[model samples]
Target: MKKLVSLLLVLLVFTGTASAADLSPDVRSAILVDAASGKILYQENIDTPMPPASMTKMMTEYLVLEAIKDKTITWDDIVTTSDYGFFLGRYGGSRVFLNEKERRTVRELYEAMAIYSANDATAMLAEHIASTETAFVELMNEKGQELGMKDSNFITSTGLPRNILSDYAPPISLGEQVMSARDAAILARELINTFPEALKIASTPKAVFRQGEDDQVEMINWNWMLPGLWYELEGVDGLKTGYTEAAGNCFTGTAKRGNIRLISVVMGAKSKEHRFKATKELLEYGFEAFTVEKIAKKGDTIKGYEKTKVLKGKKLEVPVEVAEDISLMVKRDSKIEKVVSLTTVEAPVKKGQVIGSVAFDSESDYLREKDKQDTEINMVAVEEIEKASLIIRLFRGIKNFFLGLF
Candidate 1:
């Protein structure tokens, strides 16, 4: 009876303190980050670069969304399929089977690319937007650099194997698209933040491409974490999945439970099932271990934010405000300290001008080691402080001069 009790105690201890270390995922790299704060929750080989199959489409999606935002393109805009795009689909790659000279709307192509992972549709959209796939690839690389994705290099819109386009007799090995797990998370966050509507498209479990009376193509979303898939989990919504001979199986997944959102990236997994399994583990660990709380709202006045003296303005001083909402993810049941600091602003201050910052800190060694304990939030001026009239300015200058002499 005592031995049985001891065995049960050991099981309880392991279950209570379970972490990522307890599970072994057959993947080359993986990472999980708090979608709101971009704080890494769990990681393994996050910096190692691996092939990024169709995951490259996220950048393509970003550019398409940007163009729409700037009015350069619209969802209703007709995209004329180029010969290059047609040939890519014509050849044996995954596509919506776009014929040469086929005309499709921007929205249709985006759905194909985002939902079906259609290589032809991706190339078609790229050519329509940039006049050529090569130019679109250049844009993708530029955006990657802008996003600080140091370990990523995008040579194609589709994450297809490099040699697929090669004419070499011996099939000379060309470099494939590569990205670190950390870089993938950064890219995913940017995608969801910039055009959250894209998630609506990605969340679909199955969609019909070019739905019509003729040649209707049935497209299934590759993300198994979404509903109706083998690994369906509540709250799992968006993301992209990729696979290639070189890349193995990869997935960039995100889920929101209440106010907390998480982004998980798994790359180079042994199989399709393994990649989704690994991602689920990371996400479950994050949701189980941490909770995100809204510490402050944007424009909320910080307690004790004293009015700053203004040299020449309509009012003698102005109230300070938070520039943006502040939210932090901390370990469950852990306590933290919020430290607010203010900086005095000079006259001629404009509304929303940053002046100070608030920081969160803790003495917990575990929090410090995980690099999750401390963070800073910026403060801004709530109201504008106009410059005084020339006569008033001159009078103040003379008064200041006399005061300085005294």
Candidate 2:
């Protein structure tokens, strides 16, 4: 059985593969991916680079959350609004109307930036974290590179178009911040996976900042397409929005329905409404077209992999079962096919030791030649296999020798 199974694994690995769905979305640059698997479900010019606008704040928000978690900064730590950050003046894209020398807590600044998309508040927070906006932008780029965001170059912590006199950029070069739709999706994925709490603020349509004070102002989230907003889409939580003359209207959003979560990015739409409309269409297309398909469940035995030989063990063989529940986002129209491979191992096998794996692929004849979209899980030993006693091992060796003589 081991010999036969080994031969089958070679065939499955080499001869079997499937292709992805060819979906044409309505947007200049867009991508929809499964948040868990990072699988590209649909894309249109996803690699095309464009200015990301305020979506760049998501990276700032992520770094701030990291500071909070690591104790480098506390939510209640007061941050002073430097004259440079406070005086961006009305000309700056968006602001919380912070006053120079005014102090506020890290939590308030974070809320202001996340909900209001305030450029002023973003600058203050950047200065607080790194003592200067220039140093903070350096941190932003370093983190982006670490996240494998090759196409992202964040010049501003606020994601605003770089301006010569504004603190967001240096006094010299004036260049727009840029990122690809695919890269934005990757950044959003990292943010959500690492700090899910950030979504609570991103999804909120409105909140009060500096409450019950002379400077108190209501900060309404710019993202109106989220749930509880003007145009409600169930499960549409986060993440950020961006717009500049060069970038046009851009949005990077995420939604979760049941066990499946998806990230969608749309860049360079004609208008704010158009960006949201295009994003909504892409997200709807994803949920309408794909579903979570269960490949295997924990403790379930593989049909052909009932047992594997255990050398020098009290038991000659041991039962094997799926170690984890495996599932994948699959096109509803495609059929699922399984490719199983079980490995035979020597004894002293511990319970839960991985001994093999199974992969699931699309069985649609049309996708036979397409790129493979599959998810796999390991098969594990269900029970421990202790070494056999000396007498038992000797008896087995003698028996095998006699059988080989025949």
lDDT of 2 at 404: 100
Report clash pairs, candidate 2.
18-371, 18-372, 19-370, 19-371
- Global Cα lDDT for candidate 1: 0.78
TM-score, candidate number 1: 0.76
The residue-by-residue lDDT of candidate 1 on 1-406, one tens digit each, is: 0010000111011123546577666689888888866777778888888889998889899999998999988999898877766767777367888888889899999999999899888987887788877788788889988877888887788877757765311123324578988889888988998899989999999999878749889998888778998889889998999988889899999999988899999899889899988888888888887776677678777556644556566566778877777667766644556555666556788888877766553332211222343356777888899877888878878998999998
Per-residue lDDT of 341 in model 2? 74
User: What is the C-alpha local distance difference test score of each model?
Assistant: 0.78, 0.78
What clash count does candidate 2 reach? 4
Best by TM-score: 2
> Candidate 2, TM-score vs. the true structure?
0.83
List runs of model 2 lying over 4 Å from the truth: 1-25, 164-168, 171-176, 212-216, 312-316, 361-375, 388-406
